[model samples]
Target: MSRAKGNLAEDKACKFLDENGFMIIERNFYSRFGEIDIIATKDEVLHFVEVKSGLDYESAIQNITPQKLSRLLRTGDVYMKKNSLDVDFMYDAIIVTPQDVELVDNITI
Candidate 1:
């Protein structure tokens, strides 16, 4: 998808997360490895979120391949180190579709 589309999707994802009681800390955080779409916190645990949008949930989720996960890990490490954060964190994904949006937490490689 295009950059604009990605931004739109991320906006929606942010709103969704907000409604679900998450505090958004950052958006479009960058590092040499890649970008972490959103950083949020809830119940004292930090969440690194990846926003993926497509015609369907499967297609969007499929975009998060192993390589992408690797980059997220590396970028997340960079974020934590740069900010001197020492909190519990987990990888997550928000799948955005025309029908609905879903949050998948605790994603693992």
Candidate 2:
């Protein structure tokens, strides 16, 4: 999607996360590896979130290809290292659709 659309989705995802008790620590963090859409914390665990939005769930979710996941993981590592953070963390995805937004935590393969 375009940059504007991506920003909008990330904004919505931030709102959703904030409402659900995730403190928004950062947004659009970048590194040599790639960019992390959102960095949030809840229950003492950091979440590196990827925000994907489309007309439906499948289209949005399919955007998170393996290459993308690899980039996210690498970037998350870079973030932790750069910040000297040794806390627990996990990769996550926020699926935004016209009807609703859902947060899938600990989205491991």
What C-alpha lDDT values do all the predictions have? 0.96, 0.94
For model 1, which pairs clash? none
TM-score to native of every candidate shown: 0.98, 0.97
Q: Model 1 — TM-score against the truth?
A: 0.98
Among these predicted structures, which one has the highest TM-score?
1
Instruction: Give the distance in Å from residue 47's predicted Cα in candidate 2 to where it truly belongs.
Output: 0.4
Estimate the lDDT of model 2. 0.94
Each candidate: RMSD to true structure?
A: 0.7, 0.7
Residue 6 lDDT in candidate 2: 92
lDDT (10s digit) by residue, model 2, range 22-57 = 999999999988899999999999999999999999
